[model samples]
Target chain A: MALVELHDIRKTYRVGDQEIAALDGITLSIDAGEFLAIIGPSGSGKSTLMHLLGCLDSPTSGSLVIDGVDVSRASSNQLAAMRNAKIGFVFQSFNLLPKFDVLRNVELPMVYAGVPAKVRRERAMAAIERVDLLHRVHNTPLQLSGGQCQRVAIARAIVNDPKIVFADEPTGNLDSHTGEAILTLFRELAESGRTIVIVTHDNGIAARLPRRIEMRDGRIRVGVEAAVSATTPLISPAHPGEEAGA
Target chain B: MNFWFGLLIGLKEISAHKFRSFLTMLGIILGVASLLAMFALTEGVARGMRENLAASGGVERVEINNKDPSEENQDLAFLSPGRTLDDAEALRKGAPLVSLVSPEMNLGNNTAISRSNITIRLATTGACPEYLEVGKYELAEGRMISQIDVDRVTRVVVIGASVAGELWPDTPDYVPLGEVIRINGVPYRIIGTLAYCESDAAKRKRAAGFSAVQDERRTRRMGKKKRVNRYDTYWQKNHAILVPISTLFNDFRTASNADGTPNWKLDRLSISVADLSLFEETLNQVRGVLERTHRGIDDFGFDTREEWFDNIESSVRATRTSGSLIAGISLLVGGIGITNIMLASITERIREIGVRRAIGARQRDIFVQIVVESGVIGFIGGILGLLAATGVIQLLIALSPAENAPVMTLSSVVVSFSFALGIGILSGLYPAWKASTLDPIEALRYG
Candidate 1:
């Protein structure tokens, strides 16, 4: 079964009297643990689709089901709960809180999720160790290099054991060498049965992922659903929630 | 998020921008301090007024003073004899609620009580023994005027502390109770000496060992030897010299009447009430008796301490109202300062807020964070203001006259501190709302 299903989702914004469609009738789906990439130039609605999949926002029309739960009509608080329980996001700028140490930044999602302190600490530490950043857990974001900061952001993303992890140009701010290192980390997370989606204009990153789709203007320009089914094998659902902070 | 955790974040936010937070809290601090100071001052003044009321024979005493005859009664004014010993005797006999009647003859303000070459000028009164209670006078040594003395018309006199101090600065141990003292060229024996008059504040000051040189300089400047009390009312009571009314009539009767029966008119008639609740009734009864004694002419009016107490209460209330207005404005200004800073602070933290919201923080969570931050600022400012107010109250106590020392009460502290915190929370409303309503998508994109 598909982890995320979108049926002709439409999002429109009225600029004065003119209505602009940012997402116009895009349909997509992905199985559990499949590493996917959405690639397009600026204003191609790729970011908007990523935002929708991350549950940071809702579509103006059409249905969106994530992990078997309907999300298109969820309330703001419900959207937030969905995000906390099933989705995590990594930004192009890392977006780690500047005021918090790496460990605290990683533990922030669970803090909002009302996890107990001891469990939050243990899981946050485990996430940091998985990202190979346990040594720098006490260091603030400003005290780390771009690659290190991105790793901390990833640790934060997975600390809540979300069903899906979304990265928007996650390596855009790092050098080629460091970018490859972050890609390797995401590949390892995928192999561990965590579904990963990367939004990037970098063709090289898109080619490296198991499945890739391209969008133009406000619609999908290329569909690789058939290509992905032929080349990639489906992963058995792991749920990540059981081992979370255990 | 729990409020405690939110407050922790708020504390961190404030600590990250120490200078801005302190400047923002300055208004609340000053407001609380000024509020506390105002409460203490007005409260202290009210207490002082109450003390003065009790000192001046309290609410139960009534005095009959001269009043102009009404237009209709003006024709019969001359026919009436006026407030005299006869009227005092009639009130004593007729007014059932009249506890005691003290008829007195005042020897004008310019009278000089002299002994040998030394003399001190002060107002003197001649009265029966009831003046001891009505006048609130306590005899330290020697005897008060007796009925026998009034009947014999003896020229015995009782002097106050000031008079004794001036008349015999050498005889400190003895009051010269049996010794003759001259009053306006007439020799009179000093039969009593009054105790020193001072207020509780003055007593505390003396016990605390106040600056002796300043007190000495003040007394020296006033040309008095031993004036200790800060209030002149106390000095008036201390400097008194009382003699028998019969002695005053024999020696000084404001030039005997045309028929030569010795005017017989009294200068002042003070009456004490048996029960404080029936004071007005007793006063009416006294007036009725005096009206009959004075032949139905309205040549006298009544004075009760109730009017003085009412004036004190009203004046204190006015002071509190004005003080509260000023302090409240300052507190409001403080709250505005908090609002201004919170708006700017949230504006600076928009991206941070976005990141938080993106990580599953609800709008209410963001709102609580901002409001709690504002409350933290107010709480700290209130604590600092309380500390500052303590020093301010102490300074007030030192600066104000001893009789009216400003007091810092527990209620004022609680009230001011609560206002500081309440202003803080209230000020956060607009800014928190604005921050919480920010679009998560746009906020994440904001610089």
Candidate 2:
């Protein structure tokens, strides 16, 4: 079953007297362990889509089923619980609590999940260790390098062992090398069987992901190769053989 | 999420801004302290007044005086002829509400001599045993005058503490039990010493000149009367001496002629009513009966400690009004201080509030947290204010004259602390509510 499914989702925001269509009848599905990148230019509604998928917001209309649980009709509190329990979010700005140390920043999601303190500590420490920030556990975000802070953000995202991780320009603030290192972490998380959806406009960043979904003017563009099936033998061979035979 | 954690965070935040927090708390502290101190002073003053009244006589007792216009112009000798021992006896028997009726005949120009020859002006009065109860006099030593003493006209007297100290200063351990003292050159035995009245000093100040003049006028008015040279000298510490009515009348009574004919009758009577609750009723009844017996002579007026107390209360109320006005101003200033501090705190923590809301903290949570923080600061300030008030009370007590010193009561502490806390909460409400209702998005965007 698809880990996440959206049925004809629609979202509209009232900017003054004008109604802006942020999401328009977009139907999409993604399975577990898929590393998909949603690529679009600014004002293309990709961030809004990411917000809905990450459970930070609900679609204005239509049904959304996350892991087979209908989330479109969920209450705010329920959505918060869902976000804390099943979804991890990585913001473009690496939104680490400035007052908290690296370890505490990583442990925050588990804290929100009401995990036992001892268990949260162990899980957070392990997550920090995975991000190679164990030595910087006591250093606040301001004290950490850009890549190190992004790693801490990733560590926080996965510390609760969420079913899906949403990254919105997770490498936006970092240099190319640092950005690559963060992308590697996303790939590692996806390889560990977590569903990863990244939203970014960087083509290089998008190409690195296993599947790329192009969004334009609140709708996904058609006529592109189905990136998810590109690895399957039938599609790759059929496309190349068709071209050769023609 | 846990209460302790929230409290710890709050404490840490408060401590981080120590001076600001202290400044915030200052309003509450001054407000509470002023409230407590003012209340203490008011309570103390009330107590002092009550004590003074009780010493003069319990507030319930009434004094009935002969108020005859005809008698007003009469000489003391003739005036005494109108008031008789019968009036006292009549009040005791006919007035059911009157518990006890003691007729007091004050003798003027008397002298008391101690063993050391110290002469003190005597407060010589002749009354029955009920006089002591009506006057609220406790016998510190020896015994009070009894009915038999009055009937037999015993030459016995009770000395006040001041008089006893003056006459018996050298006798370190001497208890003036059955000691003999000279009254008007006549030897009278000292039977009792009255306990120290709380307002003895005030009475001394009031009586310094007036009492001596009154005595002289009484003496002069009783022309050619057998003037009892009964000296009732009240000491400085022990203000007055009491003598049996018979002794005051017999030894002090003067003759109009050398032939031993009495010059004037002892007619003036002072009646002290028992059970002050019945003072008004008894006074009316006695007045009615006396008016009837004296043939419409409006020669009597009833006086009670309540009248004096009313006068004192009015004066005290004026002082209290001024005090409360001052305290009100102080509280207003304190409240403004609280508002200012809370507004500043809200401004400083806008971002923190935004972050908390972003993390799923509800507006109600934000509201409660701010209010709780303000309340906690208020409570702490209240405690400190109480301590400050207690210190002020102690200082006042130490510095005040013993007789007029005020006391701090438990009610004052509670009232002051609660008022301060209420002020704190009230002052904080607007600022805290303002802070809580800020839009999360806008707040997050705030610098």
Candidate 3:
């Protein structure tokens, strides 16, 4: 069975009598251990899709199944539990808590998961070591470079051993070399059997991933249906939604 | 998340803005301090007033005095010849619930008393032997006047501490036990000395029983050292000399008509009843007898110490209630200050709240964090307030002329501290609720 399933999902936001659809009629499924990227231009609803799939929000009308449980009608507490136990998220701004040191920032997910202190410390340190930020474990985010901050965000996402990691432009603020380094870390994490879903506006960033879905006008325009065959090109031509290659 | 982690987060936020936190807490500090100080002062006044009342025969004793002639009662006063020993004797026989009745005749102040070169103008009073127990007086040396002294009309005297110090100033350890002192050009033997100064013996007596007269000596010593005026009502007993009623009548009863008819004259009558529960009934019966003795003219009035005590108590309570109300307003202002600052703090940390919410923090967690932060602020304010109040109380005691100034009790500290903490929780409710209701998507997007 798919690890995450969205059946014709729709999300509408109301502003002053106009009902704007941030995500509409997007039916998709992500299997376990799949590495996928959702690529879109501005106002393409990729962030709203990530929000729905990651349980940060519920769809206006749709059935969402994660790990064989329907989460569309989930309570806030149940949604929080799902996020803590089954999913992890990284943001474009590298949302590391500015007050916490590197190790503490990584330990946050497990802290919410009610993990014991001793076990949380050990797992957080292991995740930090995996991201190659072991030397800066006690340093706050203000004392770290942009690349190191992104690495800390990656460590935080994986510390709870979540089934899927959702990263939205995780290297958006970094230089080219640091962005490549962060992408290499994501590649290694995906190779280790963790499902990774990244949302980005850059076609070059999307070309580096294994499977890609291009979104436009609140729907999947191209590339998700046949991309499941596990082999895709380094760069696809300018399809209907592949405006990034223009 | 666990409570310790939440508390640590709260502390970190407060420490990050130390001056703001301190300013937010200043109102609560002043409120708590003033409330506690008022409690201490009112408590002291209550204690002092009770002791003062106890010194003059306590709440159970009653005094009957001659009434002034008012516009409506002038005819009655003229018809009555005033209270006398005959009225006192009649009350003793007619009132069954009455215990002791002592008639008093006070010679006017500045009565001449001399011993060799030393002379003093003191107030003197004439009374029977029962005066010693009814008036709450204790003898420091020798003996009080006996029934024989009254029956035989003996000329013997009991001097106060002031009299002893003045007449026998040269004697290092003065004991006027058997010495003779002249009063109004007539010689009288000093039979006893009143206990006007507190000594180890006084403490022992106080511990042994409820002798309210001991309070008088203590009050005088605590006050200034200037000579107490003989006309002062409460302190006059500290500067008086007592003699037998017969001696006063034989030598000092000088008021009479031209035909040599003696006036029926007495200054005051102190009555100690057998039981305070039956005091009203007994007082009515005494009034009846006195009225009949004076030929149906009500020319006398009475007062009880219990009534005096009640009046003082209610007045003090009024002052205390008003003081507490003022302090309560300050506490309210302090609570509002906390609410305002907490709301501002939550607004500034909206993104942080969002980040934590995305990391699986429940709404309850956010609520708990904000409330705990406000509670910690109140707890800190309570401690500092108690310290400041203690310092202020000490300064007041040092500057005041009274021997004892009020100090904060442990109960007041605990009460005020707990009240302050409750204010914190109450004030934090709206702000914490506002914080907990924020949407993660919207909060994260807040600048």
Candidate 4:
């Protein structure tokens, strides 16, 4: 079974007596260990879709099965628990708690999960080591570089060993080299059998992933079969034999 | 999620905004201080009054006087002549509530001469042994007049401290015990000297001087009727001699003396009740007894320290009302300031709340966290306020005159501190509630 499944998902928002549809009857499924990118321009409802998929919000009308659990019907508390135990999120702005040190920021999710202090410290340290930020673990967000702060945020997201990791424009705030390094980390996480989903407006970031799902105006442009092109190698240089359009 | 953790966070927040926290606590501080200070002042006054009353006589004692309007209009002749030893005996027999009763007859006399020939006019009262207890007198030397003295009409006397000093100035160390003194050229043996009646002695002296001036004014007002009453003048000057009641009857009574001596009678009877709690009941009972004895004349009236004690409630009430008004205003102002600051804090922490909520914090958790933060501000403020009030009270006590200084007790500190803490918690509730009820999505969207 797919790790995340959306069946006829819909989301609507009320804006001053006007009902704006943010998602319209979207259906998708994501399997385990898939490194997927959802690409769209601003106001294309890609962000809204990401929010629904991350369980930060629910679909107005649809079934959302995350790891075979009906997420759309989950209570607020259940959704919070699911987010803490089953999913991880890394925002574009490197949303590390400004008052917390790198290690503390990484330990936050485990803290919320009521993990024992000893285990939380061990897991948080391991996550920081994974991000190559173990040496800067005592530094607060303000003291860290942009890339380093983003790494801390990523470490915080994954420290609880969540099954699915969601990155929303995760590399948008970084320089090209730093952005490439982040994408490389995502590739490594995916290779290690973690299901990684990246939402980006950058085509370069999207193209670097193994599979791409293009969205426009709250609708999928590439069909599901073509979108999951597993045969295609991620981060591959263009083949000389194939034309650019083909 | 842990209470200690929440408390630590709350304490951190308070430290982060020290000045704001202090201002919020200011109300509690002043409220507690004023409360304690007012209590101290009132307690001091009550204590002073009790001491004064006890010195004069026991607080439980009551004085009863004749209610005759005719007696009021007349001179000492009517007032003193109407009361007699027979009437005193009747009261002793008739009154059931009285534990002890004594009859006293005062003679207006001025001529008192010491063995050394020094003379001073001192007020004198003729009494039995029971007069010692009724007057709350203590003897410095010799013994009070005995029943034998009354029975034999012996010329034995107890002199006041001032009288003793004036009469025996040459021998300052001598206290006149078992010595002879002459009053109106008649010799009497000094039996006892009074102690701790100095204040009353001084007051009597001033009253005598005042009455003399008033008597002179009265003489000027009435030209023909202004006969100089030597007995009245003598009573005004010599106000410190006590003799047996029988002696007063024998030497100074109107019927006994052929020289037309003024009538010496009891004008008033002072009753001492056993228990203060029974004051009203005892007063009513005494009034009923007296009325029955006097044939429902309604000429006499009853007064009690009950009224004085009751008056304390009103004075304390006024103080408390004013205190409460000031405290209420301060708390209201403090509450408003705290709410404003907390609302700002909540607004600033919207994203944090959203983040916490998203990370599995229950609604109750959110609520508890915010409330805890606000309560912490109040608690710290209360402690600070308590310290400030204590310092103020200490300073006030230090600056006060020695006679009126108040001692601050532990009860005052506990009361002030708890009151301040209560105010803080009470003031912080609504704002914390408001913060806790925000929608996570909306909060996350807030700037």
Candidate 5:
């Protein structure tokens, strides 16, 4: 059985008198340990799909099954628990809490998990060490550089030992060298049998993943497809003309 | 999530905007401070009034006055002899609750007492040895008029300090105690001199810190092992002479009926009880005896003196209640200020809230965080208010009139501080709820 399964999922958002479909009839399944990317232009519902997969939002219709539990009927608290226990998220803006030092920021997920202080401190230190940011454990996010802040965010995401990790335009705010370093870290984690999902409009980033799903106008353009090789370089950047290939 | 974690988050938020947090807490600070001050002042007022009543012998004594039976019933010219010497005797014998019964007859104010060349017209009260005990009067130089004096109808008197000064200008204060003075051409020996007297105004000034000499004397007396009577030097205006009731009835009984029989009469009757708890029962028993002697006409009336003290206490209690109500309202307004500030904080920290939620914070966690933040604001405000109230109370104790000075107790501090905290929690609820219920997706997307 897949680690996550979405069946004919549709999400409609109302803006005054109009009805807009953010996710329309989307069906996808993610196997354990799969490195995948969902790619699209802005307004193609790529971000919405990321939100749904992360259990941050529920579908307006159809079913979402996470670890064989139907989450479409689950309460908000259960979604929070699933997010805490099974999933980790990295965002483009590197959303580390402004007041928390690196160690405290990384300890947050476990804090919500009700982990004891002694254990949480040890695990958080270990996670920070993984990102090579142990030296700056007491430095707040405001005191860190952009790349360092993103690394701190990554340490926070993986500190709880989540089964899967989600990155939404994780390298959008970093320089090429820093962006490359982050991608290398994600690749190393994926090689260690942790499933990873990246959402981006950047074809350059998507071509490196093992699996790809291309979306256009709230619908999947390429459906689910496996890469021919591990180091495939590029398909094309997201553009209006790319939809003609469907 | 742990409570300390919430508190840490709260402290961080408060420190980040120190000025804004102070502004938010100002209302609670003023409300709580004023509340404490009002409570202390009202308590002081009640306590002072109680002391006044206690000093005047109101708490332990009841007064029964005679009323003419013809005043109540027009059909009867005379029903029974009213509250007289016999009623006092009956109450003293039958009423076990009573500790002392003192009957008094006013020998007209113009009565003259002369010692050699000095003749002074002084008002006299004819009473027994129990008068000094029931009225709580202390003898300064010599003994009081004894039971033997009343029993033998001896012409003896206890003179007040003023009377002593009037009779002997050059003689020492001790000379008047044993000196014989002529009253209505009969020589009456002065057996005792009542304690020195001061008016209420003078005592008020001393208590208000106007008289340093009095304060020094007060402190010097405190070192003694014997308990000095504070009531002895309090606001009593003593200027009368005391004689035995039996002697007054024998020599000064002037009123008579148509048959020329001496009417057994008394101007007033004072009864003192052993305990305040038994005072009402004793008053009821005296009333019962009086009613039986007067043949159930209900012509006689009594005064417990509680009504005077009770009026002061009730008014003080009312002031305290109203003070608390106003203070509560101000705290609520302060709580509203906190709510407004909290809501603004939630709006400002939307992204932070979103980040926390994405990291596995449940709705309850967010709720606790915001509530704790508000509670911290209140807690700080309560502490600040306590400090400010203490300063204000100390200043009042230094500057205000002694009767008006506020009294701060430990319980008042605890209650006021807790009330401030309660206001904080109550005000924080709505804003915290609003923040916790926000959708993480929308919050993260918020500008």
Candidate 6:
């Protein structure tokens, strides 16, 4: 089943008397377990597409169906609910609130969701452990290195068991080695059948994902002939993290 | 977000900038303290004035004094001969509400009353029999100055408790019913003695000049507070001495006295009403009769305890209004300070707000957080203000003498505290709304 389906999505913004198109026309679909990356240069509207897919914003004129629910008419509050329930966002800056500790940062999504404290704690701990930063749960974001902050952000994202995780340059601020380690974490997450989408400018990282799409002038450069290739299972679900390091 | 979460955030915000928050709260603290203190001081002054009103002749008593006639009637003032027995007599006849009339000829102060070698200077008033009721005095023994005493110009006197005590200090039980006392070498018989009254000597020591009595017994009382709880509340009444006006006619010595014309000059005329509530109306009626007796010269003025009472009440009211206005301005300034700080804080935290929104926190959640932060500032300031008001009250009581000590009331505390809390919340409103209205996309990208 497709986890996200966008039909002719368009987003426009007006600057004084000029109308600018951030996302012109894009139709795309991603299966529930597919690991994909949307790659483009700066000003190609890839970030706008990521924002629409992540439910951080609504398209100006388009139909967005997430987990088989039509979210085209969702209000800002309803969009917020959708974001909390089904979508997780990882920003380029590893936007963990500086004042909160690692454990508290992981638990914030559930805190807004009104989840029980005990359950939120257990799930946040599990997500932190999955990111291999369980030892630093009590340390604030400012105390952690760039990669550790990104790991905490990832933990926060997956703690809710969201249907799709959209990471926008999750490794942009990290060292090359640290960036590779984060990529390895995403690989392991994908092998576990987690639907992960990366929106990045790094072509090398895009090439490594199971499916890849390129955007230019707010339009995806893809044809119908490659739909099967993009939708195919890229990682064997049975192995989980066996080939994570490889 | 839950209310508890919002409260935690609010408190954290305040703790983040402790000095700034305290400075902001100072305005509210002073406002609340001054507000409550003003109420306490005004209440005290009002209470003291009411006590004075009750002591000096009470609400139902009116005294007519010689007021120089107006500029228009200045020429006719000599024709009226000032407030006299004739005006008192006319009031007695014409004004039905004037229940008691006491025409007095005051012989000034420090009139020496002597018995053999011992003598005490006392305030002397040549009064009528009705002076007892009009002055709110009671005789312990013997008769008051009767009409026959006035008609015959008899040399008789009525004395206060302090005078009787000083004249015969060794004889505590003596009631000198027929004893002859001399006034500046002039002989007169004591026809009555006022009831014996004494208070804590410590109070009298503190109030050295308050009484004319030189009794050494006042200091014998240990440090204790006891009110006499009677009509003789004023210390002046305790030292009162009265003689018949006719007996002291030559002492006052109006120009008509030497000419042998019937002298009717009186220093003042006291009028009493049976109904205390009808005092204003009866005073007006008595003034009208006095005007008629003076043939519209307007040479006399009606003096009432109500004027003193009213002066106190109006002054207290003015103090309260101006004090509240000052306090209100301070509270408003305090509120503005909160708003200014909150807005600055929000501007600094725009990115954090965006991050929260991206993580699924709603605008309403952010709004609640900001408002709760301001509310915490107000709530804490309110409690502090209430405490500060208590200290202010104590300071006032320490500074002021007795009878005007400040009284702290529960209502004053509640009003100040609640008002502080209300100011806090109200001040947060615009800033909270400003914070919640920020666009997530723009805020997230803000530098």
Best by TM-score: 1
Per-model i-RMS in Å?
A: 0.8, 3.3, 0.9, 1.9, 0.5, 0.9
Native contacts kept, each candidate: 0.56, 0.02, 0.48, 0.30, 0.78, 0.56
Candidate 2 per-residue C-alpha lDDT over B288-354 given as tens digits, one digit per residue, 9 for 90 to 100: 7666545555666777677888887887778767876777677667777877887888898787675
For model 6, how does the per-residue alpha-carbon lDDT over A13-103 read when each residue is reduced to its tens digit? 9999999998876667788888888888999999888888877788999788999888878888887888888888898898888877899
- Measured by lDDT, the strongest candidate is 1
Instruction: In angstroms, give how far residue B357 of model 5 lies from its true place.
Output: 1.0
Which digits, one per residue and each the tens of the lDDT, describe model 5 over residues B106-212?
76767888889878676678898898877777788888999999989999988876566657655434447678988766788888888855435346666766663
Best by DockQ: 5
Give residue B135's lDDT in candidate 3 (0 to 100): 80
> Residues A1-246, candidate 5, lDDT per residue (tens digit)?
778888778899999999999888777777888899999899999999889889999999978898888888788999999899888999999988888899999999999999999999999999999899988989999999999998998898899998789999999999999999999999988998889999999999898888888888887775245563333323334532232121
Off by over 4 Å in 2: A1-34, A51-87, A92-164, A173-185, A213-226, A229-246, B66-84, B107-117, B168-187, B197-237, B251-298, B305-336, B426-428
- A best-first ranking of the candidates according to their DockQ comes to 5, 1, 3, 6, 4, 2
The DockQ scores of all candidates, in the order shown, are: 0.62, 0.18, 0.58, 0.35, 0.75, 0.56
Scanning candidate 1 chain B in windows of ten residues, the lowest lDDT window is B211-220
Q: For candidate 3, write residues B1-447 as lDDT tens digits.
A: 777777788788889899999898898899899988888787666755666566667777789877775567676666776888888788888877778888887777778999997787887888888788788778888989888998898999998766776676555348788889888888999999887633232334456673434343345447746553343334565666899987888887755547676555888888887798887887888888888888777778888887898898998899789988998889889999999999999999998888888878888888988998898888787778888888878776556423134657788788888978888878888999999899887887788
Instruction: Please give, for residues A1-246, the per-residue lDDT of candidate 2 as tens digits.
Output: 778888778899999999988887777777888889899898888988887887657889988999988999887567667777788777677767676789777877665566778898999999999888888999989998989988987888887788888888888888989888888888887888889999999988888677777777887655433464532222224332111100
Q: Which stretches of candidate 6 lie over 4 Å from their true place?
A: A102-104, A114-139, A145-148, A159-161, A176-194, A223-246, B33-44, B65-105, B113-122, B126-182, B186-239, B242-266, B276-301, B304-311, B386-419
Clashing pairs in 3: none
| Per-residue C-alpha lDDT of model 4 across residues A99-182, encoded as one tens digit per residue | 668987788788778888899899999999999987898998999899998888788878889889999899889999998888
The residue-level lDDT of candidate 3 at A71 comes to 93
**What TM-scores do the predictions have?**
0.90, 0.76, 0.86, 0.76, 0.82, 0.76
Q: Return the lDDT, model 1, position B431.
A: 99
lDDT of 4 by residue, B1-447 (tens): 666656766786677677876665565556666656655654444444444455555666677666554443444322333445655565577665665566777655554544555666555677878777876777778888999999999988887655665565545447778888876676789898766343332344446564433444456456656454443322222235888878766775657446676565564466667667777777677666655544444455554545655675577568656865676576556656667777787787778777676555666666777777767766766666666656766677566532234545567556655665666666667766776677765665566
Q: How would you encode candidate 6's per-residue C-alpha lDDT over B95-120 as one tens digit per residue?
A: 99878988888765677889999987
**Where in model 1 is the C-alpha error above 4 Å?**
A116-119, A226-246, B142-154, B170-179, B211-218, B221-231, B254-261
